[model samples]
Target: MNTFRQHSKTRSRAVLVAGGAGFLGSTLCERLIADGERVICLDNMQTGTTGNLAALAREPRFSLVEQDVCDPVPRSLEVDAVFNLACAASPPRYQADPVHTMMTCVMGTHHLLDHCAAHGARFVQASTSEVYGDPREHPQREDYWGHVNPIGPRACYDEGKRAAETLCFDYRRGKGGGGAVDVRVARIFNTYGPRMRPDDGRIVSNLICQALADQPLTIYGTGEQTRSFCYVDDMIEGLVRLMRVDPAPDGPVNLGNPGEFTILELAEMVLDLVETTSRVAHEPLPTDDPQRRRPDVSRAETHLGWRPTTPLSAGLPPTIDWFAGLVQHRRADRRAPVAEASALHGVA
Candidate 1:
């Protein structure tokens, strides 16, 4: 067994975050740095933007390494914890390159687990609620074996995460001389907030952007499919708490708000919030789309003593405001080239 440093209860420890440039990842980085921990953020930037890390870039405690987690990470840096949040989470982004996505979830996790085991550091895997698939259970608990379509469009993300969870547990169990790796898996549900890419294609961003532009809100299927949305702040808190548990849970634990809302209801809420003239437009439902997703979160509440306090009403306003700025910036950037061309023509 690798001899490594044990976590000290008194000191702020060094941490590595694999996807620290992303929406969720960057927020986590900020939170850690705020708490006076030294943070090394690793990202490939396929979906993550540098814009998300603008604040962290100025912070001396935070450092960023632009690298893919599928590759072996640097071994020299000592850290007390590793957060594996490197996968491309948005459906459209992951579907665009399914093979890479699968590799990221599987191999990326494999490499990070090895790193954690080598250093005897705690490993936290950001597993997703998609592991529940088109859940047969109404409110999914930690024990449910999900009904996932392995050959379907969404399988890349859904199954990849499932495979990741298995790998995390296996690492925790160890191959020989007892379990050396300490691992915690958080099965995250739908989360939304600032720094989310405007075109990420998740329903929240999609609806908010379309409403801001006065375009029709696209409704896939009958719009009755349900999802629970957790505010980014609450989601980050859940993840932080999971990583800090004295004796981590052996299996994956759910982390998300239990408040459920249908797709149609979500659209209506966005329209009302933004006060836009956008109408509903129907579209074919994507294949393998989960009909329902709501986490039970009992394990989180019991073990971590964590529950999301931000309601949807309170969360939506800030999210909508962020998207509004994004839309305006996009519009201005779009017109910049045209304006320059027109100025040149007039000069000629």
Candidate 2:
């Protein structure tokens, strides 16, 4: 049976991290492991790659389970906290399998929250900024009901998350089974950093990978769309703080950097950082893409005392370096196979 050590309230214990092999989840898992906490890292590897968790494979305090959240929840695990971050957050990837995405969000969240309720553990629902839709508000606060299209291409992810949020609260209100579990919802904004798949289709990773490859950076629409980007480290910090804060609010709180930048500006910054000769290539905008998306993190700041400190300029260098290394390694691996073949044929 899965179990955890029980001690002081502030002491480290076993935390179940759904999607723990993912870019964001891997980072969160690493952070928790470093802090002396035992982690049950669960993922289906749909969008999450095993490479992200390579470093933690040997960590004694960490355990990985290759299971999807849509599947049955493992029982008898005495978990202290449950972080539901199992759904795909990328547009191209999630839209490719809309029904699965929705099911992952709704059913997956149901199973995780059920586990938390059964154990009387804290539940942290990783909601998204996509729930705000195209944004009728300037800086989206938690109170905004949002303007999402239920039938749009992006609706699977948006509505899935919205439904997941409802499930979190419903569980809190004792509407579902098991005992009442402490639930905290964080509406995460655009986050980027190392471990993000080079082809995940997010603007940051896309621009960085493209710049490194010296390819024309693709811009959808006029490139005037604005978004707030938070480095993954800062995002993890906010999530940890939210999970630990006492007297936590039942409503969702925004977790993102307030520093906003236009797509054109971001493209320019990436180009400048990489010093690439690549120019911008315009394309037709995807359906229901948000024009401007930024979070008002006042609630996070006030409630959890969390705020992102990394500026885009400061965060880009490390990310660029990481992607550059990946590009180099890929080239090396490709050459290695060819070299071995040539060696067998007595060619230099």
Candidate 3:
């Protein structure tokens, strides 16, 4: 542990979290702070909002930098580690501007690798389950070469992340340095919790929002497609452990809940959690949506000795409350006449 020279309740080593203001990144900052490590949060805010990390800014152990990672990160701030999470994770945002999103994965990751190389810091790439693109095998292991469509809409993010992982290994395998320079590739699954963007269009939030409002919960494709949800807190804990482990594991490791739920099942659970009197409706799932997703946790258990701690029933209520807060707050803003006046006057 790096001794905290100043700021923070307990001593923490200097660290960097690229894209630290987003859902996963913000949670990561929180975990690192609790572990007594000073955190340097970096973000361009293309999709991430500062409001996600606003509370942490007041902490003595935290520092924020609003900048794009595609450009070279400033070389001045020294740090002990880097968590590269700059790319847009959600389908809506990643597909919004395909080129920019791809750059954030490829070019943005390359830039951060440069900084990690210079600083001799532990670097972790926040890889995703999407890399397994419509998997041909169940419970994808680290070695699986996925069934990705290069020309598909998801290719921008899927391939871009694949490219980033390649870079991490190249540096790790090529340098063959002391364990000092570490690299970890985390293949995260569908993680959700508070602080996630309400408009992210993910199933969890979409169902919760509609259910709470008494609208028909849209069940895409008979709701047969399956996916596992990991609470963000559990994910960040796993990631932090992976980052600090020895010998630069050079892993394409899986870090997600092995438990799976069908889309309809998830919506029903959400309705129950929210106590909503809502009906469910069927809709077409978008192109390239994975029909099934379940992580093979054997590697994670073997390597990191970690797995998710929060079950959906336990996790959903708090997650729902967070979305509800955002919804209620936004609704209040809309109901107010001052908000109407400001909106009419083009004030954001």
* TM-score of every candidate: 0.92, 0.92, 0.89
Best by TM-score: 2
RMSD values, in order shown? 6.8, 6.6, 5.6
Which is superior by TM-score, 2 or 3? 2
Tens-digit lDDT track for model 1 on 1-348?
332235566756789999988889989989998877878888888877666766655566777787899998878867778999998888999999999999999999998888887777888999999998899998999999999999998899999999998888888888513356888999999999988888788999999999998999999999999999999999999999998887788678999999999999999899889978899999999988889999998899889999999999899999999988877666322212433322211100
TM-score of 1: 0.92
Full-model lDDT for every candidate: 0.85, 0.86, 0.80
Q: Per the 3 Å backbone cut-off, how many clashing residue pairs does candidate 3 have?
A: 1
Better of 1 and 3 by TM-score: 1
Error of 3 at 224 (Å): 0.4
Q: Considering lDDT, which of the candidate structures 1 and 3 is the better prediction for this target?
A: 1
Which segments of candidate 1 are over 4 A away from where they belong?
Answer: 1-12, 176-179, 331-348
- Candidate 3 TM-score, true structure as reference: 0.89
**Which ranges in model 3 have alpha carbons more than 4 Å from their true place?**
1-11, 175-181, 331-348
Taking the tens digit of each residue's C-alpha lDDT, what string does model 2 give over 74-99?
A: 78666888888898888989999999
Steric clash pairs (candidate 1): none
Which digits, one per residue and each the tens of the lDDT, describe model 3 over residues 183-223?
78999999999877767778888899898788899888879
Clash number for each model:
0, 0, 1
